[model samples]
Target: MDPLSDILSVLKLRSYVSGGFDASGEWAVHFGSHEGIKFHAVVTGECWVAVDCEAPVKVKAGECFLLARGKPVRLASNMAAEPISLQFLLPPTHDGRIVTYNKGGEFLSIGGYFTLADGQADMLLNVLPPFIHIRNEPSRATIRWCVERMRQELCDPQPGDFVVAQQLATMVLVEALRLHLSARDRDEVGWLFALGDERMRAALSAMHASPGSPWTLQLMAKKAGMSRTTFATRFKEKVGLSPMEYMTRWRMILAADRLTNSTETLSEIGHSLGYNSEKSFGTAFKRVMNYPPRQYAKL
Candidate 1:
């Protein structure tokens, strides 16, 4: 897999809920602080979205937004419409989980929340803005398709509608991240954006492809076709971590996954990640994960 896929694949999703909401007649709803990421697309009509106390942005049909972490969000037809807590406004789910408020029909949206495994989402979220607003554009037709299909899955229940909708939710998330990376400047710094950098990609790809390989600064620099000093400085600037530091973090994240899900012994897991001894691997794991392999397994 590519770097983005690698990171996203490692992120364990606990549960996901996919559905649509409909409202009409001077309606506003306050979505209290939520866990994981909440995403939505305006299927028809427009709404004012205020997130984390930031100024409200108008979202028209065909546009979408991703809200990360536990940010509180408010959506309304107009600010003049008093906002009610979502708890009060949300109608019980339909057969496929569509909900409604007020008269329900003038404004419509399709959305869902992903409950990622605790601490797992930051793997992807760290490189993203707290809130991402994707405007409707020729380049974002995928978003439109995904939203439309999601609406179908929710509006008409099927045997596997839940499974299909969850996958579509993940697809939207990836598209949003890809859009963000493409729009960023070359000088932008973040592991996700750095993956898109032409000059930095080779070196990062090498590390991802073979985490167990012996790697030195000169070697990594060579992969990037640069001198050690230049590559180190440039990589740090663009990726927000020295090459080796990034490698260790990546390796530890892999190890954490194995520790939680695999039956391998500490030494086996460590050796697979290039550590020669259990002690050395445990030391590195503690530094990165704050827990030894045995202890972390129970978590």
Candidate 2:
């Protein structure tokens, strides 16, 4: 698999918001929008997640739930069952889009947008489950700390408090994801686990270390200490792409970053990445990115 693609799958490129609501006698909050990922953290209250397609999932304090794919869900408190307060940490938009929150009573939350500027974050996203419910496990100290920091930042009326709070909140989410990947079942292979494997890690490192090298299946297989057929099959199973396909994707990813961050001529970038000529590089770049190199660079 292309490490860049894997990483992007994990890094959510959307806006986020964090806040809380006091449930007075079974009040319910309905979130109905095709926005970004929505995360509900039960900081001090209890609630139930009622969705149309699935049974209602109960929530309690110190537990966090993610509503992936921005599916519409309802959160409610049933006084007849349990008494709980509701806190939410959610994206502000879907797909870098914008979201508006009509401020309710003393809701304490933080939110921000996430984008994968590099391969690391992208690899993490691909392995994450569609919805992750994190119990207050022992290994989640970092996540807890981040969440507490978010609460502190949200409460503090300091200048740039929102900015600081949002950053912390984002960090918390990232850490949570990291914890999830580390503890995820080994049988459920995801891109993150693939990158972490010894063999795949070495191959990926080699590719990144020398993107312009004449990488071949034989060479990669040798580096991985596996037979050519074994290497190819394993790589495909783990990465969801052939070796050359992964290489091409990585090259395009590097090219896009260069286009955005550097002033190098397109031809120079092409040559740097082992392209024979500017036109050849341009064609490859366009095919992968759906934009001319120069045009993409301007963005």
Candidate 3:
């Protein structure tokens, strides 16, 4: 698996809930705080999105965005519109089905939220921004398939709509991340965004493929086809960390996953990740994770 795939697989999904809001004219809906990634796409018209304490953003038709953290969401046709709780707007009986605020038709959106398993969300979640805004045109072509399918499933409710909508929402989340990677119009920087760069991706893939390998800066530069100096500079600039540092972090992450899921002894886990002794592995784990392997497992 590639780096993204490896991290996603480790961050196993728990459960999902999806719903839609259709409103027209002057209106605002406040979606309360939740502990999961919230994703939504505009099906028609436009609205302003305020995730958490950040500034309001105008989301145009055909555009989509993912709220990385489970912060409160305030969506409005006008930012100043008085907020209305989604719960009061839609009774428990009609939840998950499209509900309207006032005369519906002008502003329509379909979205969902999902949570990852315990003790593993930080691998990717921590690397992402508060919200990722993916515009149409280029990104649309990449995830339009999932988006269109979701639009259909959301607009017309049928048998098993809940399950199908949740499945499609998950697809949208993954594809949206992939789309953000491919688009070149953004100013975001990090390991997640660095996957967009071809050379950086090559080096990252090498690290993910054989994290146990005794990788040096020179070896990583070779994978990226650059001199050690250039590779080190560019990797730090693009990934926000030195090449070897990233390798160590990745190894520790893999070690943590093993610690949580595998029955391997500390010595076995350390050796598998290229540590010569259990002490060295424990030290590194403590440095990166702020806890010893055994203690982390207990938590």
Q: Which of the two, 1 or 3, has more TM-score?
A: 1
lDDT digits (tens) for residues 179-244 of candidate 3: 767764556668888888889899999899998899999999999999999999999988888998
Give Cα-based local distance difference scores for all models: 0.85, 0.63, 0.82
True-structure RMSD for candidate 1: 1.7
lDDT of 2 by residue, 26-119 (tens): 3555666443456656666566776546778777666677655456667666524532222242353432212223433322222333444443
Clash pairs, model 1 backbone: none
| Per-candidate TM-score against the hidden true structure | 0.94, 0.73, 0.88
Rank candidates by lDDT, best first: 1, 3, 2
**Backbone clash total, candidate 2:** 24
Best lDDT goes to which candidate?
1
lDDT at residue 64 of model 3 (Cα atoms): 87
Query: Can you tell me which runs of candidate 2 are displaced by over 4 Å?
Result: 1-17, 34-36, 50-52, 79-129, 185-190, 291-299
**What's model 1's lDDT at 91?**
49
Candidate 3 stretches with Cα past 4 Å from truth are 13-17, 52-55, 117-120, 155-163, 184-188
TM-score of 3: 0.88
Best by TM-score: 1
- How many residue pairs clash per model? 0, 24, 0
Candidate 3 clash pair list: none
How many Å off is the CA of 228 in candidate 3? 1.9
